[model samples]
Target: MSGPRIDPSLYRERDRIPIRRAILSVSDKTGLVELGQALAAAGVELVSTGSTAALLQEAGVPVTEVASVTGFPESLDGRVKTLHPAVHGGLLADLRLEDHERQLDDLGIRAFELAVVNLYPFAETRASGAPAAEVIEQIDIGGPAMVRAAAKNHANVAVVVSPDGYDGIRRALAEGGTTLEQRRALAAAAFGHTASYDRQVADWLAKETGERDRVLRVEATLAAPLRYGENSHQQASLYTFAEGRGIAQAEQLAGKEMSYNNYVDADAAVRAAYDFERPAVAIIKHANPCGVAVASAKTVDPIASAHIRAHECDPVSAFGGVIAANRTVTLRMAEQVADVFTEVLVAPDFESDALAVLSRKKNLRILRLPADYRREGWEFRQISGGVLLQTADSFDAERGSAQHDSSGWRLVSGEEVDDATRADLEFAWRACRAVKSNAILLADGGASVGVGMGQVNRVDSCHLAVSRAGKRARGSVAASDAFFPFSDGLQVLLDAGVRAVVQPGGSVRDEEVIDAAKRAGVPMYFTGERHFYH
Candidate 1:
């Protein structure tokens, strides 16, 4: 007839868990000694296993071994350590429930206030190419289970999965106890750590067995939240995996926080820059290259000349484009970069004085990257209710060599091109791969003087490229990502003074197109390779 009376001591708001006892188990020993010494000084009891207990004891920190706490020796090559009822009871018992507290007391199990656990280095082991048996053994079962239990009951138990959390733990210890909010954050971090660990394990297993299920598992950690996506109305954030590359791992030296568009445009520009070995500059806008230029060997200042040549290609369109250089930025180059209305600038390195000069623009995002940074393995694209994964695009340096026989270029025109024209043809062909479909690029004097991309018809792209090139098109070479379906597209370039053309020629009317090029006295080479970007 009456509701059960509740114990006031069992339920309270805004209570901090007092650190009476903690379980410490980790494979990475970074900062472990300092943390154990601090916990011992605070009069908190620490229970550890194997090396952890021995290290703490040797450091003169009072730590109890797990065998003593559970009254059982570790078995199965130490795999069964910390899996006892005593450990789980201490971690999962709810202090706020009278029934839970009574059960713990009846069993003589002490409640653990905190748990520090870092999983085995499975990623490192896999990367090292160890034997399958050895790699599988490094996958920890007990660590994730313990951490998950502590995280699930974070209301009374604090869990730390990595040494990165040691500082916060120490600060909370100094303040006498961990706040509820702090405990919640630590729990979230612990869950993330465990999730990544499991994802990596799944990936390794899939690779080992040559999985036919095609089940995909991608693990990513949050890098930062952007102000907005491509538009202010949309929301977006950046992510990095355990193995990050390119802009995801780049170091930001100065300027405002990078936006969604900045990241996309910067990545595109940087990828384009590495396609060339010479000192080169690429200006990108709306995920397409507005202009790209490589420094001439004879130029007095290679970097400055590259920037000037690239900027001169389409000065109006380059207003707010992102700029990327493969080499370090000198003071002179920085001065040139500052003169433009650039949204972001990325390079391998920058001079101190150059950085000082560029810092004048407060909104310009500056990032430093390695000269050879690029993505590896698979790339993914998400669609409605599904996902697509494929190999990443890479520029093959051997494609340019004559001995490779990669493309099977055929002469369908006036005569073979000169060495300089051949070089320009190869350069423009590589740059065109990164542009959208129906793309055309003009290269001459070690610069991309003009680019036309995202066109519905091939003829229109040719006209757009010729217009952008202007006087530079007089002696420049052009590249097409695919075969020309009709002869009209070739005629447009011939009218615009294009001297030579390189295309992946496989059209049904290929003879007609070659006849048109021959009629116009412009040499055309068929690469027998097609690169399409949607």
Candidate 2:
């Protein structure tokens, strides 16, 4: 009987020739020495370029230089080394193609069965705050070329682009060489590697050139798949952009898969946590701050303050809310948090004991994010047909005084404001920025007593806010999203015993409103700018 007929397309001739040819060129030479040693032990010929060849040779692994393979020396500061046809032809040619085989034979070029290339550290170089000249110099030209070539011909060539893939490639080569499936997977990884590297370069260039009309390259990694979106039937996934800091990158130390609502509330809590300078905790629900408090550094019990404030605001709303803190969570903190039925807890760090205690509640999501989270650069919002982009609202804490300046236009009449009352007015002004449109905030001292947000009418919001404050509304300062149109709203607040008020001074009846405050003896200051949050 004749020998079994073998299909030509089934495998490359090199599958019969054995794994002996390997090309390695990388800007990151991590694990290159060990990888080269493994290939050498397998009797593979190592072809390399520049510092890679030097490193391999230094490690006693024989390496044939790219200059030897191309018959042309590297020039123009190593930029012209691997761009030659000899290097690319070896990588891109299909061993299965008759024409490709013929061309290689006629050119006296040896096909490279394996290509290992990693691009220059463009992201790292740019991150160092170096000059543009230094950054431009580090951009890789030939490395990507070799990688693309190998990846394009993945049917016959194996491409490895990451140090993490070194051991896998080594193991495969050691075990009868890489299979076609392995080659295809490596090829996909190689393309992804090059694409991300190019994106970094593109984004940097765009920033340098101020090209807003240019295509926006948003590269993000999926953090998790949400259980559901706004509704149970809706599907959702969380993708974190590269620039975001805070809970976007937080690692889940424990808990069930986060839902869409959980992520939204967590973000609100984290933002509030970042806003406060001292050790603080914020409990957020339905994308609104429910309760927030500053902790004494000596005691540093954010959990207690958060719980008490939550109950004060509305204990029912606090249930299943997200909690965030700017400091490490302790056993005491965890115990207090456990008392409330919270959906998630986010902190900078958590003690081992705290983690153990919190672990008992298996369904609660816990996240540990990096501290010092702050918004940077631009803010983007998606509308029905287009994206709206703007610089993030200014968080310039130093730009304004915490003390109210009576020299400014006063909308309220007859109110003699003391220093303490003035401080509360300033506090209420800052609090207003975080509330929704037509919002009103009532605060006594540094803590928020009542918050009315997302109301259609300004006066109604003031009434609701004052009602929420209850007895605390008395002697507290009130802030309006816009100037009071009529003295009726001022009369309502004064009836509630609100001692001071702050609002934007753009109303036509500003004089009437100032007289109302003056008549009510409630000190009122008007900031020139309106802070209306839609």
Candidate 3:
């Protein structure tokens, strides 16, 4: 298993190797022309392939084509251009080893001191629903090969793989080449780039061809470096996929930068807000909603009323929590929000006057999302060493679709369900879907009055909700994510003055629970569906 043994004599203290020649081949030519000019001005030879060389030539920078370097014309539609030994040997040579240098000289292989390569847009191509031929063509061969070679020889060669890195590379070369530390960092990035590129290709091929690969690979690029994670002791960064916009893409219009917990809790807040088509607001603390409320139609100032009622649900817990509104934030809403110690706020848009008022809170993190911003694609959650993927829970119970939706909800007992109660039950059920396990969500009229979660017993969750809502528990509809295994939970809700209930009623004691609802004179509906989140 052992390969070549290292010679201690080869180790020597020296400065960075002068970047004498660079091989540049990129699908993303951003900053390419300027970099070529800077390298040429610094007396560095530029060798490129295909349109890259043509671009440099057009820009008046001297560029030697790969065909000229290898003494072979590009064949197979430019695929064979950089596969030549002349291109790879130049990138992989270890200047520290005398034998490597001798082999390079004897074989007339030019050692490339720098390599700039960004591979074909395979991920973009595959994501765009491109045909098999187009996706196959985007599986870059020579680009990854050269990137790996240059990265493996990090001691003497510097590799650049991202356009974001172009400016720094140019500045380094112009200021006196790259440092050993920087080269090592670039080498690590290069390996990661090729590995991610290959992973995307593998994923696309396996899924498109219906080959169920056992292993899972999730790839994403760095979005932002967070100030800290959930705690000050931990480090964290944000990563985003190539497809759609997420919390990382939200604009920080006028506030301090968001931390790790801010992004996490903010996403929860916004999701709860988006679930409601009406003017809604969600107040979240520790990834759980403290209160969620929608403005009543009778309110003259809907946004302000939504915020005030949501905060009233649990004013103590709403303190320092993230708040999100599906509607534009108005000056009146801003004035009400400023009265509380809100840590973060997210809105579709903000009136200029609202921003003028909210900007006074220097520590408050405010974010603005496009009115149409919504998440698409799969949901991913990581365990110890693997990932769990599923389509997001886009299951919103249509206002009256419950009668026709497969899991058709029907009234099971007690008084006839009124329209107002039905609307409130729907709101509570939607909010309950977002709560943690053993959840019991209570809604008064249209606002989320109380939320009880993370309990081992359903009865205890009922107790928590009743206690949280206080007097508001009277006449408020309740939603239990799953069936009440025992009738005791239903009795507890009834004792707290809950008039109606919604739950997925399929349990060993379903008859007993329905009997309990009937005896308590409460209207109960069986959704024929359960929503348990942990």
Candidate 4:
């Protein structure tokens, strides 16, 4: 493994290295001809690989093929093109080091002042859902080797990995040469580009082979700088996953810039509203759902009606809350939405008239969901010294799908309910999971009448729900995210004239809870599945 001896004292320091020769090999042909022409006009030698050399020669630019320098033709379907020592030695030779210069001169290898390389489209090929073999072929071997070699010897060479840097490289060449600082910055960027590309390939291979990475490679690019963090005094920024389909990809149709809180509440609203099969709307405030509702079959304007009912659940809290709708926003929805002092509204799309109406409210943020948006993958939460990862809370109850399996549900007490009340209980159960625990939700006519969330005790949550619902709780069905430790919470709902209840019954005092429901003559169903959100 030992290759050569090092003599630090014999190495000289240089500020700017004149670029007399450049190696350019790119899979992306964008701006390649122009860069070649400019380098030729500047009297710089251009050495390129197969197709790149052909394109430059066709454009009337003088160029030398990499095969001519290596004395070996590109073999193994071009996979072995730039892996030879001639290319790497030229790229990695430290002209400041006397030994390195002597080795290059004795070997008849010309040192390259610049290396421009962009890897093949591995990420794009994988994203296109191409076959495994096709995706594998797009993983460039020689390109990364060249980029890393040039970046490692940044003191003697500059590397460019993207077309965006072509202009800067051209300007640097026009200025005689690139400064050491410029080379260092380019080296850092080049390494990052290769790192992200490798991570993508590794992650995809892991998924295809049904294996998990022992060491996670998390990568994100800076999307924007937020005005502040959770509070005004704190600093914050937004980093987006390159292939994410969540809030980061949402398009703002019309509105002011999104704040930190706006994105948080908007994301929560979207998740809550999309839980239903029918047209639904969820109003969220401070990362908690203020109200949630779904439209009935007879509704005239489904989204508008759902929004109206959801807002009515807690009109006071919904004043400046964010709204998310599962369906498109129509003119009717826009008119009703404009009447309220809302902060943000996100939906799949907006009708022409609806957009015109919503655009009038300059301060109201209007976001359109990405067409292919879907909730998938894992959820990550960071703690003081570690991170927690789990699969997302997803179910088979997607929109337009068959109803979720209810064979696991058991009617523990009271008489069996009609179809209408059963539908209400089902809606309440799904909505309750989105609320923070200890959570209690009341539903009637496919809409939330009251919601009690984030309480320390189930009994307090029950009381809060009843208090918020007032008279509406009389005929509403109740859903608890988890089982009641005692009968006190069920008693509270029963006392408010709640007609039926749905909960995950697994407490030691389950019989006691069942007795209380039986005495109230209220139907109680145990799903045996608990959902607790914190």
Candidate 5:
């Protein structure tokens, strides 16, 4: 007899056999007792295994054990229980074939018309960080075998993989018995469930055994469907990785539906907020940091500075931008943010008064993230017919040495730096690390005043930075994401009255640039690190 083909259309045909026999097995056991009782009330025979059989028997439900059907006791620590031909043959045999019916009769094998099976708690076991032996023991073999058999024969056997499907199964059995279309859907779910389970096992083993060649396992769920793509007419949806902390998991307290651009800019802004230790805010536009500021509690309100400085950087560009706050949103902060027309606002939390004020504008999206939330793992991007994955930009300046630190770093030629000048230099260094490629940033007393991003030439970016700062560029510290190729860029910044500068200091003409700063009466620091975002 040929194996049963799992086809939904076959089950939906007018002439179809109703499911009369079912095999039930699960690791979770949730709702199993009630489901068994319902099946019994429907006059369906129940065949279970191991603990499941014992549980059903204790509950006064009739159940046939796999060993009883196979006429062999479960051996090899229950690993060899359901692998017998008597079990799989019954599920795989085509019920509509006369020769298959004769073969089953000769072997005295009863066909299993339905199967409800779930694998062991592999994810839960690995998450517990248990002993290696214990984790290995939890790796199930017989469960997957039975599930695959049932799913592969879904045309004749209904396959159920989740407890959530119990109600649907019960309803079908109560009304007109299981239909072929329902069985086919259950078969698809069964395959997906087993695939996910196997992937988890592979990932866990790779981590435990340190296998370098194993494929990385990734799982994600849909966050929401966006209204459109980059434009209004395109199609798009948001999906977030399931393994770690991410912005997709943030709680939406009171807000409108988030758009495609909102998610893009919001991710950029939140990453910038994590770069600072003090009270800070980052305003992002088109996936780039347009304005970022760090203000002392007494000197200036960080939230107010964020709105003002971001707008000042590029008033035309700040329109419809995404705003993010590392701290909770206060009433004062809400008022300042409300002044500007923004697409979304994300913060750790929002005060009642702040929410009340912001609610007046119904279209603005407000997201409340937990205070201690931190990003995890790497990010994945899809290209044309391929995928690109890399570690996320999860860098914390306070925790370790900046990536640019190197032995080549030295004060080639600059004015003798004072204590205050060095402090400003470090502040400028941190600010520069947050900017994009060919980046130039100007800050005074740790507050970012001007920024230039995505310029092809470093000198052009320097000019743009100074131009944006205008009068504010004077007496401010300047930082470049990369080492200046020539001394001309330093001259432009010095001519603008930039008091100090910080950079990676790797250019071959480093001596010339340092000499230029020293000649211009400016103090410079070489952090031996460069941060260039593309």
Candidate 6:
């Protein structure tokens, strides 16, 4: 069936719509008084609801209460005030039609040329750990409805949804009215604001009822536009979530602006460094860890020692790599880093003296982690026709359990070592998770000696690790992110004089791998959990 059509002459083509009247309602009172006074000075009639009316009157701006226009008191705890025809009729009216104008005059309804609204803080209320009832009450009904009505009729009305738009609106009013182009832009932003608000509310309710898969609503605002993406030809920009601090929200203290590659490497370095409880440092290149190390028992200037040890694992790869430290960057660590050509350095903070020393390098990007920074929420990867989502990889389940502690791991071969060697094995297991699979990491004295990552096969990864370690591979403990599918990979490490090994041990050839370690008189432990970072 054909849809109903209207004559084109019935629609108005307005270049500018004068603000003869407006409805002001906001949960946030920022710039409210100033806006009200400006409207009064322009001889614009103001119709406001509840607290908005009272606040405008207090500021000595003439105003009419919504109750006066609706001819009924705000009932049901003020929820029914703006739902009446007197309010919506004005916002949704087609002023270009003579029939609509006659009906408005007969019903004592006046058309509104503008609407200033901001919804209740549903996202902030829920994030504050408020009770379910309290948070639910913050879900705005009238505000979004009014906003949608005004925005839909934006040909004759301008809607402002944020305080940041106040100055622009004021300037437009001073120039006689808002142009159709300006109104269209404001309408677009209004719809986006409401969409994000509804998404937040819907997502929270889904979680409350244990129906997380019911909907997936992602909202973000552009933080900045980069020069390019991974390559100069591709376009890229950074976007930040409404709440929470992450790489996008981190404060850049010095150096050049971050690039697409810099954020990726910086985030990987942070994940690798913060995986340990002790002071730790990680150096990353191309989203793969080149070096990772934790503090040793006998280290003075523990963080500095960790940086030096991490860098020594693969000094050549560490060049131009991004670095992350779990603790504050001190002068001792900064001095050592100043010698290396690094792309980015991220830490919780930097000591004053440390900043003074590192600021000399003009092109090195330095980022300070946000307060209470956390890596949580689902990780997303895009494919050709779909997206893959999973909970962020974390050690919460294995944090203090047998999986992270060597005492709880199943010893498949050889005798157990002392405290120091056990510490090395634990650090190796955790650090290997940050490497790309097929991955192998070798560590001694709580520091990585070599890392093999992003290889096609486990045997190749083993060779890469041993070759990187050189003589340091002797007596070093090795960790495989996943089980060695065959004995050949295990033999490579065993032949390299590796004294001990840790792996998930789920492959069908686990028995053969254990037998290989047993023949070499090396301790082999199974974590039963594999971390494959593709």
Q: How would you encode candidate 4's per-residue C-alpha lDDT over 47-106 as one tens digit per residue?
A: 999888998989999999999999999999888898888999999999998878999989
> What is the C-alpha lDDT profile of model 1 across 365-463, one tens digit per residue?
899985557665677899999999887666654435441232457878989888888888878887887778899998897788889899999999999
Native-referenced Cα lDDT, model 1: 0.87
lDDT of 6: 0.91
Q: Give the TM-score of each candidate.
A: 0.91, 0.87, 0.90, 0.92, 0.84, 0.94
For candidate 4, the lDDT comes to 0.91
Task: Answer with 2 or 3, whichever has the higher TM-score.
Answer: 3
| Predicted candidate 5 versus true structure: per-residue lDDT over 385-409, tens digit per residue | 8777776553454436554222233
Candidate 3 lDDT over 107-181, as tens digits, reads: 999899899999999988876988899989999999999999999989889999988787878778767878789
lDDT of each: 0.87, 0.78, 0.87, 0.91, 0.78, 0.91
Q: Candidate 6: where are CA atoms >4 Å away?
A: 1-4, 57-62, 212-215, 298-300, 398-404
What's the residue-level lDDT of 107 in candidate 1? Answer: 98
| Candidates' RMSD to native | 3.8, 5.4, 3.2, 2.8, 4.1, 2.2
**What shift in Å separates residue 416 of candidate 5 from its native position after superposition?**
6.9
lDDT of 6 by residue, 1-534 (tens): 984577988876677888999999998899999998988999999999988899999999999998899898999887778998999999988787787889999999999999999998898899899999999989999999999999998988899999999998899879999998999999999999899888888888888998855555667899999989999999999999877677778999999999999999999999999888899999999999889998777877889999999999999999999999999999999999999999999999999999988999998999999978888567888899887889777665544445755656888999987787888898999999999999999999888999999999999999999999999999999999999999999899999999899998988988899899999999999988888999
Clashing pairs in 6: none
For model 5, name the residue pairs that clash. Answer: 11-180, 404-528, 404-529
Instruction: Report the C-alpha lDDT of model 2 over 450-501, residue by residue, as the tens digit.
Output: 8787888878888888878889889888888787888887778889998878
CA lDDT, candidate 3, residue 153: 85
